[model samples]
Target: MADTAAPPTAPKSMAVPLTAFAVGGVVALLLGIFSKVHDPTLDGTTTLGYSNVLAMKTVVAVVIGVLAVGQVIGALWIYGKLPIKAPSWLGKAHRAGGTLVLLLSVFVGYHCLWSVGWETGVTDTGYHVPARTIVHEILGCIVFGAIVVKIVAVRSKRAPGWFLPLAGGLLFTLLIAAVLTSAAYYIGDNGWPSRA
Candidate 1:
């Protein structure tokens, strides 16, 4: 008699890509909610006498954006998605880049949340801040949360090969969006000060 049994399906653990995306989304949403509801405090520590907090954060933002771009390229190379051959050390470089970006993000986030908060208005300029400011705040928080998800996905043994690349791409996109809306806008509106 012919065998009637069907081939076994791939294990549920293989669905890491989809699960990672969902986890990232949920965590990001939670962070947004937390940022809105939490009370903010004035953090003067980030600002030295000669330093402007906004300018400082902007510098960090630029660094983060550059690092995030490197992360995406490294991921592509490591996953064999890039056209060129990848070197053996590319994977290690990718991990190091990700770690550095995450650490820098923490510093940036602390200053943003503790020093400025939501930034609805500026007393000196009396500039009517647009809706984008709040949106940028929420997006910044989400970027950090998404990074958390990416790290978990990276360490998961059951995660599929595609999961890492997808998480990395998502993280890179979010980081760019946060930097563009906040740092780029600030620099474009007010020229970077020599002192801070």
Candidate 2:
């Protein structure tokens, strides 16, 4: 006999968290980036004004760097291009990597308070934040979003591997953007114009 009950569909889990994290990553990346134009030091610093962890750009940079590598590893693992050895450690690494990026994202996000102050026309200058922070915030928010999705997936019993590709792609994109945008900003002027 044909089954009378309707088939079950996957629950709408990890959607909200994922979206928030993704958007957050982009926002963070952009804000961090564009704000650099006006205040280059904020892009990196050794001062412990906000978080001691971020006192050293090397620390934050290294972690984000690792997170980027983890993303690539995860992506490769998911696609079966890379061998999956010890799923447990890989999961732990991915989580740790995500946590690191999340922290950095928060650290970078601190500058956005200033960027938004200008970009939204809060200052005498129609556009306050330089173009640098724009890309920084965007990348940071994207990382934030990817982390959200990773956490949700982990909590929902989804393999940690699944989030790797998303994280990797976004991180890679941010890296490329960071370099290109920074170059362009410097070449054009102090930094790209928020409006331009």
Candidate 3:
């Protein structure tokens, strides 16, 4: 009889990951589709602690954008992809930051879709509509879809190692783009919210 070593095992099936991703995508796509079907509230939805809806949304977006910087740093550290070693607390902070980002997105996204919906050059008040508005609207949908992917990737054991980082990067990019197109533009035009 010949002695032989066991063969290396293959990776497990990706059924769970695929299902999670599909579910996320469908949910986001549906939300985007429904949001577009609704009419814009024009003045936007106002809430407590802000001069107006625009001011609130802008501030929230800006906050998220700044937090995104920390998110990236934390992710890089946790993954050991950076030059420096990560502190023990770094991973906990990363999780907390990601959770906060998701929660904030829900609030901001609801306001945008419920109050204003999709805006165009002709519809929204203030300066004339620009190409950036269209880009922003398109990116809004993408951001939702990306959020789904990111969440699923983070929670699913079936997710590939690279998926989490990729989704994180995508979310960061989309958030920045969304902020630039709307909040930053608003600040440039009208300055920060004071009186609404």
The best candidate by lDDT is 3
Q: Write the per-residue lDDT of candidate 1 for residues 77-141, one digit (tens) a residue.
A: 87788899999988788888888999999888877777666656553468776778877887887
Local accuracy of candidate 3 as per-residue lDDT tens digits, 93-123 = 8889988988987788888888867656675
Clashing pairs in 1: none
* Ranking of candidates on lDDT, top first: 3, 1, 2
Deviation (Å) of 8 in candidate 1: 14
What residue runs in model 2 are displaced by over 4 Å at the alpha carbon? Answer: 1-46, 49-59, 83-88, 111-130, 141-143, 157-164, 175-196
Candidates 1 and 2 compared: the better one by TM-score is 1
CA error at residue 188 for candidate 3, angstroms: 1.2
Candidate 1, which segments miss by more than 4 Å at Cα? 1-26, 48-50, 119-128
lDDT of 2 at 88: 50
Regions more than 4 Å wrong, model 3:
1-21, 42-44, 124-128
Prediction 2 TM-score vs. true: 0.47
Model 3, position 108: C-alpha lDDT score: 86
